[model samples]
Target: MIAIDNKLISDEVLDEQFVCDLTKCKGGCCEDGDAGAPLEDWEMKEINDHYEAIKPYMTPEGIREIERQGKYIYDKEFGWVTPTINGAICAYGFRDEKGIIKCAAEQAYNDGKLDWKKPVSCHLFPIKIQKSRRDPDMEYVNYEPREDLCKAACSLGEKLKVPVYIFLKEALIRKYGEDFYEALEAVAGYKKNND
Candidate 1:
């Protein structure tokens, strides 16, 4: 593990390879999960604030589910998460013409409807972060690509020689700032040179 500040990052971030193959997977990660994409407390407010602006990008069913379930729901196992359509796909996700699940919030953001992107959890997919159980102030950054959903990503990553951390550079920086990302990169560079 690479320790940085209050976080412990798993070695898999540098060793494991991954690059989302949207054509092959069709954004399965967005829809195949048992719960909706995880949300921070502030993200719930962002959804509530930008609902009208983002509603146009969302499916009718998603809007209805949001109305029925309230913007986000508290999960027993995962704390807060976006509401799903009847416990299926995320209510914020819409199936496109190519059958890929697209995030309405992200679409809205790209269209200049809101400043916030989709949930950080969604952006940082294949990599999950959680508060450390042993130390309340510490966090754990883990590489956790789904075996069934991410097979193509893994294969492509190997072909491209892109490490999991490299594949997630933007997301990591977005979530943890550039310092953390540089720290991870430095570790990767050091390991590569020594090995």
Candidate 2:
């Protein structure tokens, strides 16, 4: 583990190679999870504040789920999360013509209706962050490799020579700021040279 700025990063983040192979996975992460996308307290407010703008891009069922469930729901395990339609696809998700799950919030952002793109948790997928149980202030950011869902991504990443840290640069910067990302890059470079 690498400690940086109150966050502990798992070494797998530097060693592994991964770039989302959306064409192969078809955004399965949005639909495959038992609970909806995890939302931070602030993100819950963002969703409520911008629901109207995001509503048009969502499916009717998604809208209904959000209306009935009040944007998010509490999971016994996952705490506050975006509500899912029929306990499946997220309340903010809709399928594209190719059957790929797409985020309505992202669509709204793409259309310039909102500044926030999807939930930060969703945006930083495959890289999960957990607060330290003891310290609370410290976080552990780790690369979680799901072989079944991410095999194609692994293959593509290896083919393209993109490490997990590099592949997730945008999301990491979004979560931890540019300075943190640069620090991580420095760590990656050092590891590469030393190994």
Candidate 3:
């Protein structure tokens, strides 16, 4: 584990390679998980504030689920999360004509109708955060690539020589700030030189 501030980043973040292969996976993470995308308090607030703007971008099923669930739900196991449609796809997710799942919130954000893009949890795919075992307050950055859904990504990453940390640079900076990302970059440089 690589410690920085209160977070312990798994070595897999440095060692493993990954890049989303959307054509292959069709955004499985948005629909295949047992729970919807995890939501922070602020993200919930954002959803409520921007629901009207995001509504038009969502599918009828997604909009109905959100309307029925009232933005988000409190899961016993996962704390706050976006409501899922029949315990499946995220309430904010829709299948495009290509059959790839996409986030309504992201579509709205891209069109300048909403300020928030989507949940940071969704942005940081394959890198799930957890509470450190040694210290509950400490965060753990875990690289959790899926075997079934991420096979193409893993293969592409290995072929391209792109590490997990590099692939998620933007998300890491968005969640943890510039200093944290720079620290990871520095560590990657050091390890590359020494190894």
- lDDT scores for all predictions? 0.91, 0.90, 0.91
Candidate 3, number of clashes: 0
Each model's TM-score, in the order given?
0.97, 0.97, 0.96
Residues 1-195 of candidate 1 have per-residue lDDT tens digits of 999999999999999989999999999888788798889888988988999988998899998998898889988888899999877889989888999999999999999989998999999999999997788889899999998889999999999999999999999999999999999999999999998
Between candidates 1 and 2, the one scoring higher on lDDT is: 1
For residue 69, give model 3's deviation from the true position in Å: 1.5
The digit string of per-residue lDDT tens for model 2 on 133-171 reads: 799899999898677998999999999989988888888
RMSD of 1: 0.9
Q: After TM-score superposition, what is the CA distance of residue 102 in candidate 3 from its true location, in Å?
A: 0.5
* Candidate 1 segments whose C-alpha is farther than 4 A from its true place: none
**Clash pairs, model 1 backbone:** none
Displacement of residue 98 (Cα, Å) in model 3 is 1.0
lDDT of 3: 0.91
Model 2 local distance difference test score: 0.90
lDDT of 3 by residue, 74-171 (tens): 98877899999998899889888999999999999999998898999999989999875688889989998888899999999999999999999988
